[model samples]
Target: MAFVEGTGDEFILTCFVCKNPFGLVAQFCGYCQATRQQALGVERARASQQIISDEPEPQPVHNISSEVNTPAAERVKKQKPKRQNLFFQNMRLRLDNFKEWQIKRSKPIGATASALFIAFTYVVIQTYIFVNTAPTLDAEKYLYPAVTHEVSYFDASNSEPATAKTDIFPVKYLKWSASSSDRWTTKASWNGWTGKADITFTPAGNLETDRPVLAQFTAQYSTYWKVFRKITWEPASPAAILKLSYPNDKNLTIYFNGLAAGSISNPAVAAGSYQMYPGPFEIKFYNLNTGRLIDKYTRTYFISTSGVFSPSYQN
Candidate 1:
């Protein structure tokens, strides 16, 4: 290369490495950008070596393969395997040639599975509702203790507060398979409880017909009024009793298993007509037994047109 004598302008040289336009001329043709960069590096190394002449160094030869190890460059040069969607193509081909029996059978199989699933669900739901809502025999077995429920009040002016004028309670009767004369009863002890009415009766007499037993209390108008609504008279345990209340002395009709037991007649029951003091009535039931009497229930009754309305209300 020769420089012009009068012109001070520098000549722009094309890159020999990649055959691209560059500022200075070089020994290597830079046909590729990476090769041009390598030529520039070699020139810089030569200049640095000339500056440090005291250091021992070997002269480097121009070898294209020794410039840089680029896996991407190797991949660009090498061939790549072609991709194929053979799995999807095969599935579509098989579906086109699928048998009629296989396709039709799938519907019934799906329907059967769905039906079985629905049936299983319904069974589970039904079981849950039955277990939770329905009464269990185990609980009924344990609830056999006799109890007496009482509700009554005495006038502050007339009698003692401890004594009730009338008691209203429910009764249960159990039939015993025996002769007419034989009978069994337990003492009227509370089922370990002071107030509700409950009893367990075992029949010693003939159960073919209703049995009649005497009650120590009398059933009056005022005694039948109160406890008619609040009673749960489930006739499960053999025999139970109801105590009646009264403001005045009166005759009471008694029923044993719906049969007439005995009526109590009194004359002092007439004075309770116009007295507004609690209407005067109480109720209770007792078991007539040889050893001990089982007191089933103790309840207070209120007067109503239909009947007593305390422990239970029945027209």
Candidate 2:
């Protein structure tokens, strides 16, 4: 037997074996040995049936399109746009383009700058060489003057020394003749006596035309009466026949008293007897090609009253 009890809104059952109050679903009575196996069994069977009845019925299988339309499927199918990846690709493309532009722009500029640097260096080196190696002009050779002197003479009758006729003349100008016919000439005038004399310079046997010669002469003069004289020409001036020896005659430049007197070559020689003035003078030799001085000689040339030139080198 069982009895029911209410507690608030709930109900309880009393076990008939022990008169103990219990829940409606109690399996056994605690005070008495009694079991509710039949009722429990029936309850379990009903629960199983309820569970079977609560299961959903199977439906027909659907196509993929129907599954994709579901909310869960739609959520799974959506994808985020790869904006960061696109940005990286765009950056890489821009970097590659920038590198190409840099390469293209640098080629010609680098080449031009290198070429300009090379050209500037060459110019600087050349200028340095020229400044350091160029020759300078000799001042003493260019500024000194030729030698000169004055002369006086006499022609006498053997009667008395004091009674002998005297001629007072100053011969200052001297020149070497280039013409074969006019080997040398002396001009002197004093006290209304003016004269011109021609000299013949003949070289000794087998000697070159440039060698020192034995000089002889003849003169025509106005001395109160016209006088024609033939004699050995000996003047009070010091004299010498000069010739230059050079390795390259074509390139030689000879300076006399700082003046470009003449140039010489083989087969045609520079040979002359000079009656120089009595003073310091310069003789310089140069190579015209290089604008360089080859030789420099400074001398005091003495022209005696005997009309001869004797030169001595100072250095």
Candidate 1 Cα lDDT to native: 0.33
What is the number of backbone collisions in each predicted candidate, taken in the order shown? 90, 20
Residue 190 in candidate 2 has what lDDT? 17
Per residue, candidate 2 scores C-alpha lDDT tens digits across 132-246 of 3211111111111111122211221111332222222113112322212223222222111122232222212222443322222222222221322222222322232222333
Whole-model alpha-carbon lDDT for candidate 2: 0.38
The alpha-carbon deviation from the true structure for residue 38 of candidate 1, after best TM-score superposition, in angstroms, is 32
lDDT (tens digit, per residue) of candidate 1 on 112-179: 99999998886665445333332222212222221111121112112223323332222222112221
TM-score of 1: 0.20
Q: Counting only residues 3 or more apart in sequence or on different chains, how many pairs clash (N, Cα, C under 3 Å) in candidate 1?
A: 90
Off by over 4 Å in 2: 1-248, 266-269, 296-315
The estimated TM-scores of all candidates read 0.20, 0.21
